[model samples]
Target: MTEIYQKLENIVKKEFISNSLIVRHAYSRVVDPVLQGIPDIVIRPKDAKEISEILKVANEENIPVIPRGGGDDEFGGSKPIGDGGIVLDMKRMDNVLKLDEDNLIVTVEAGISWGKLDEYLCHYGLYTGCMGPGSGMTASVGGGISHQSVGGGGCAKYGACTNQLVSLEVVLPNGDIIETGSQANKFSKIPFNRFGNGPDLAGLFCGDNGIMGVKTKVSLQVFPRPPFAAYKTFLLPRKDRQVSSQIMLDVRRKGIDVYDLMYIMDLIMRVGCDQGMFPMWEQLKKKRGIIFYTVEANSEAELQEKVKQLDTIILDNKCEALGPEISDGNIAKWHYVEQGHWQFYHNLWGMVPALEPLSCECFVPANMYPTILDDIDQWDMEHAKDMEIFTKVTGMRPITGSGPIFLIDGNNVELTCGFTSFPSYYNGENHEGWDELNLKLWKSLMGMLTTKWGVQWYMMGEMASRIMAQLDAYLPDYYKTLKAIKKVLDPKNILSRGKFEFWGDGNK
Candidate 1:
């Protein structure tokens, strides 16, 4: 065996990676699967110590390393970004370090799936305040933190996933297992006002996308899972941007937590995930539509009240209906049976580029989701005629973006959107002009959004400038300090190789 192979075997199980193409496909990314030469071996580390050893070996041999959890970022984050490297699958490292139900906080390994976390916690009548749709399968706590994921829920009530992070247990490339915040007791007593003592160490790696170092364990804030549940899914018909905005605004006016969400159907995708559809990409090439709806409430009573209000709004506002699907009324229960929300999204679309920009989420203050859509709708109408731009507006009531506890009362009001734009972009049927069209549309919309809209979409994906653009607004000096820390911490750039650069190029 090669020196690299020998080193990998010394640390973790070797069967983590197999030579078969089938294995490669399972481990690969949605966009560029065959990265760097498909890592010679995959390793599974059980704890921070083992992770440290794996990183040390990779650094010594100068091999690439990709630390993956939940296996969700099929585009690039999880798949091999380099060759002959080791893919650290932390899926087996799932151990809930601490579940302080009283304080509403839980510490978990990066490998724990979001759904699993939600399900386990739900049993105790408590749920993660940072629950996303994927909180139900493949979404990992670490991965969500990396992307700063703002799933359909909690986003309106608990802040983004990163906001729930109270502490972190990270492993740097040099084999140092450092604990950033107080394990449990210590962190709880900290000013709670200053985030953490001194420099706020936990903030550095929260959304670094696994570039700075490997996130082995995470500490997150939890919430009452709510004994009663409701999962009402509404279907908006056609492209009535004005009415959609009005409905969302109305919900907030009446005090409802909308947990924002959005979806647009440009023919190909809807057929796949829609109830009775098979997603035969070849036949369903003519279905251009939109689904503007909301999940309603976090409780059964709240859900029913919201349903009545929604009926009034739809009727009064004059919007068409796709259909009124019954609210499951048991969201936490459904979350478990469904595996996870990544399973939710994955089940919806069948045949598209695995890397198809799943969804781009960001916040421009509260009550802005609708306003942003209003702006985009106006722009689309004026600029393009050959194209038909549809709109689906979903809002989170009792918006989580609020202060103190992202909770909703009569006075507080805010809204956010899941904002999706997968218009006319598919792999097989319209592979000709669809690529250019999709690229043009995505770029145009995003470019306008960042510049004209004047607000940042934090989880839109990793664009050096766009991601960096968030530096000053929400977190000042965060990037500069993070880069400097990466230099001092790793200096070898062998940890999460593609996440952030440390020291110099080719350091390891």
Candidate 2:
């Protein structure tokens, strides 16, 4: 153990206590950066060789390891559970390898932040061209690929990070390095699209939340900057949310162009934004209990055309326009979100409770969206309490590229609702009245989604394991085969453990 620590210290080059502190803290606790659970040791490798040497030792010792990057992942991606294992901090490996402008692709070390890549590409007038969280800030290329982080900016153009991936250099459990695709090539590259051939490995790491192996280097496709952007707002008159939601669906069903960034702000979000703290929500409440929209177009002419159709749909649905629209306001409200005002989007709720689970998220078709979410909400109201939802990606694939639109993506639009269930005792109603009862009701309602409506939960978390059992009866042989491949790639079970477990131990 002394020898291991010495070697780790050498790799990280810490000659004193202060130097050791650099290796101790993870960015997850940045606000409380000096709090509990400091890492046993931090190994910062400048290259993959140094990583292999450290990993070999850790493996031989049977010590657990945590891979880290930008120190984000709201789901707690970078947190370590090691009894006394080391953190293989990847940030030191940061390097931009190649930028193929002609191919619209860029390659970089796993530690390179999204913002760094964006700045590098922008010099040449290009980008990874995906809807992602905070391209101007720090987020490793590998971490982005791992979480499949999708945000507002690129939803209309690039989709998720997986869609932009052209190739990767992955180091498997045995420390064997293998390339997945060409420098800028994929298995499914047609005249216009790139597809993963022979079992798309990108999907394996994309959103795996780093349970398999540490990502070393990645190659991704970029895009040219678009010209002309606009935001439009509307007020659905129907105090009945169902009526308004159905109307929104109707507009999409007719194949009319709509907002790239779209959603229905609930009363909680309505109330929170109304406090004048969140500018977006404040502007949004103008259309109380109504639909608000922001549209992006190629030019002014196309913009006017889409708006004309939107106006027609609004009038037909008995919804009316609100005063002081987004076009007039420059739609600066979205920045509140990009700048980390998520609570604004949460309706009236504050920080989302850790243990809160609503009913199953069912991605019913757009036609069924209003009715489905509304019915679910009513069930929770009468049967339990309040709700929250994210509805989109029915037939209207506003996200133009490939990958998951709805974890609820088959026959439905994906929506989620939760009743507040705070972990600790707070001053007043941390979880009083409806909040307390809803926790119990949320459980029963979820069961109903599975047995009754066949509603699904996005398989991005611990719940995925439960779904896998139910799916085995319905899954094809290929899925079993994929599980086998997962076992081989991650023999030690060192990857996104339990979160998105792709392996079945009994199978082996």
Candidate 3:
């Protein structure tokens, strides 16, 4: 074994550290349809101190380190940008530390999956307000926080998962351990609030995409499950995008506290139904776009009032209501009552055999999404030639459009926008130049989305993060300030090196 491997093995058990090719290959990519990096070693540290020790070795050796959670991100966030780095697999640290019912905060090992955490919380009649990304079934809490994730459920009321953060135990790139929020006061007994104690240092790690630090522990506010709830689904009239946007605007203007509000475009409905993916909507006559809402209240009377107001807004927008049963297309009910949040978000992915998604999930203003969707249709047409490459191999071109548009805080909505295409290696044949074409066309789409629509992306993994920098999206002063902070925190740029071009610039 090499000297660096020996040092890491000293920090963690031998079984948890592996430099084997099989193990390194497994940690190389996430959910995306690309191989991001083959790490030199993959190590699972059980706590902040172990992570600190492992990072210390990496800093001393000037080796890159990437912290990986559940590896569910569609972007290549968890994987290194290139070969030869340490993949800090945090999965072994999964554990619930505390549940302070009085403070309504739950502290957990950052590597714990949202599914596991929610299952634990459910036993106590509480849940993380934003159930986390749609992949919450396996997506880690740390990954959600790192991406400012949303779309699992309750985002309309709770916003992104990061909004519920109370504190964090993060290991800086240089192997220094620190606590944020109230815990920053060493005398504090338990984690309480996220603001105040300093300038919300916890915010730096949240959505940092593992670039700022490795989140070892997380404290998030939990909520009691509201007693009274109502859910409904509606099929929109013509001009679905505009109508859906209007419905959300009216819902916000009316000040209705909806647990979830979502718009599924016509393309997804038509395609999904054809593929037998959305059985709930298979009975619809028009196969048009659909909008749904779920509301929660402490009292039956209040619940009825919110439902009535929301129903009026939906009907006034010329939407036809589906029956009240799940079999009758009430996806809203399944999504809210049956915990379908984990299963329902990725309706477009793998809709066809061998198809995978190359998408961007981000936030856009409610009013601006309709125009952006229109532009996406235009974008698809513009790239017809490039798409022909896929058509030639698979007998059909890629499907490009937004998947689900969800209403979050304010007038903003979360949009999973992009296309699904077959990877180059399909059915054991390596289609030459397929990967290059995929990157070219994908980057072009990213450029259009960033420059034209100005959408704020949350999943800034290897692809989107580098594209943002390559596109010169950040203002000079803004980029400079970020670099300065990074330099001070990580002088050697040891953690998540090459992200946003934040290589070893400290020495410069």
For TM-score, the strongest prediction is 3
Residue pairs with backbone overlap in model 3: none
1-508, model 1: which lDDT tens digit per residue?
A: 3666766676666655444556555665532222223655667778888888878887777766777777655235665554445667788877787787666778888888777887788778777765753433667787787767665355545557777777777887788876665642353543122164566677767767676678888878777754443333333445533344455557667755544323333332343434343322223333433323343345688777766765576557654343232232222223333433344455433233332332333455434544666675565554443243322111111100111111122222222222233333333333334345544554455555666666654432333233334333325476577677777876766665554322332213
Model 3 per-residue lDDT tens digits across residues 1-508 = 3988998998997999999989999999887776468889999998999999988899899889999988988878798887888999988888999999998999999999999999999999999989999999888999999999998999999999999999999999998999998999999999999998769899888888999999999999999999899999999999999999999999999999999999999998999998999898876788999999999999999999998999999999889999999999999999988899998765557788888888888889999999999998999999999999889878978999988899998999998988888788988998988877877878888899999888898889877777888888988899899999999999988898888886531211
Worst 10 residues of 1 by lDDT: 396-405
Q: RMSD in angstroms, candidate 3?
A: 1.7
lDDT of 2 by residue, 25-95 (tens): 54223211111235566666776666666666666655556677776443334645322456667887788
List runs of model 3 lying over 4 Å from the truth.
Answer: 504-508
Report residue 186 deviation for candidate 1 (angstroms).
7.1
**RMSD of candidate 2 to true structure, Å:** 8.2
Using lDDT, give the best candidate's number.
Answer: 3
Greater-TM-score candidate between 1 and 2: 2
Off by over 4 Å in 1: 13-26, 31-37, 82-84, 133-136, 184-194, 229-239, 253-255, 258-275, 278-315, 320-343, 351-457, 460-481, 499-508
Order the candidate numbers by TM-score, best to worst.
3, 2, 1
Q: Of 2 and 3, which scores higher on lDDT? A: 3
| Model 2 regions lying over 4 Å from their true place | 10-12, 15-39, 81-84, 92-95, 119-124, 134-139, 183-199, 239-259, 280-287, 290-292, 323-372, 375-421, 425-482, 500-508
Cα lDDT of model 2 overall?
0.51
Worst lDDT run of 10 residues, candidate 2, spans: 395-404
TM-score of each: 0.69, 0.71, 0.98
